[model samples]
Target: MVNCVVKNWQGEAVGETTLDLPVAKEENAAHIVHRALVRQLANARQGTASTKTRAEVRGGGRKPWRQKGTGRARAGSIRSPLWRGGGVIFGPKPRDYSQKMNRKERRLALRTAFNSRIEDLVVVQDFAAELTSPKTKDLVTALARWDVTLEKRVLLITHEPHETLYLSGRNIANLTMILATNLNIHDLLTVSKIVATDAAIAKIQEVYCD
Candidate 1:
């Protein structure tokens, strides 16, 4: 359990909130978080890279020359690995890079990772109602008020999708907006600062706290 100060749109501390999520034990926390990160990165790979082997190369059936050639080295096929324009040797092929971890472990890793970043977390009131229109400048101003540095990577978590909020934040290169329910290891760990709304914090606890 952690106590967090809740700030309004103007960055004033109006109240406090608590976050209580089950995190891994200290000894195994780092290990589990690392596994989760690796799994996510691996699973995102397209695994479309492919290379043909010597046996699969075209026009490999016909021998370039006899096994006992005259005045030249013996050749088996034009597509031989030793020959030019030939198939590759020990080349990579398409494969699944995904890794598997139990659902409980994955969630534990996520909670641990999120919990580890407590110092960088910023709890804010639901500010979607503050945005009357989709204006990037106004959003920027509000983020500045919230002490969010415009140059740093910022992850904004909200309870649900707000059209104006999304549109306002979409243009900011340093800002990434996501729903609390959609939180994942990658986004939860990559950002320098996490700015989450009051409702978002509640949603995260409801969905991930077990």
Candidate 2:
């Protein structure tokens, strides 16, 4: 459980909010969170990198020189790994990099990781209504009011997608916006600061606190 001060668009503390998601035990918290983080990153890889081996390289069937009596090192196939334009030796091949974890354990890890970042979390009122237009300047000012700076990587979690809010924040290079329902371990842990709307917090609790 955590207690957070809720601020308005002007950065005034108008109220407070609490987060009470179930998390892993302290003894296993770090391990579970590490596993979850690794799984998320690994699953994101495309695993499309591939290379040809000596046996797979074209024109490797013919030997370039005899096994002995050559002035230079006795060369075999022109596609030898030691030569240029040759097949790779023990190179990577395309394959799946995804990792799997139990659903309950993954959720527990997420809860633990999120709870660990309480100190860096900032809760704010739903300010989508405050933005009359898709102005990045307005969003920047509001973020400044919330003590977020352009130098830091920020994660903005909202209850749902708001067109105006999205437009306002899309241009901020360091800002990442995501829905509470789609929360994942990577964004939650990588950001320097987390700015979540009060409604988003409620949504997180509803979706994750089982």
Candidate 1: tens digits of C-alpha lDDT, residues 68-184: 737789887889888888999999899999999999999999899999999999999999889999999998998889888978899999999999999999999999999998989
lDDT of each: 0.92, 0.92
Off by over 4 Å in 1: none
TM-score of each: 0.96, 0.94
Write candidate 2's Cα lDDT for 1-210 as tens digits. Answer: 778999999999999999998988899999999999999999999999999998888887788878877777887789999989899988999999999999999889888989989999999999989999899999999999999887979999999899999998899999999999889999988899999999999999998877
Cα miss at 71, model 1 (Å)? 2.0
What is the TM-score (0 to 1) of candidate 1?
0.96
Off by over 4 Å in 2: 66-73
Name the TM-score of candidate 2.
Answer: 0.94
Clash count, predicted structure 2? 0
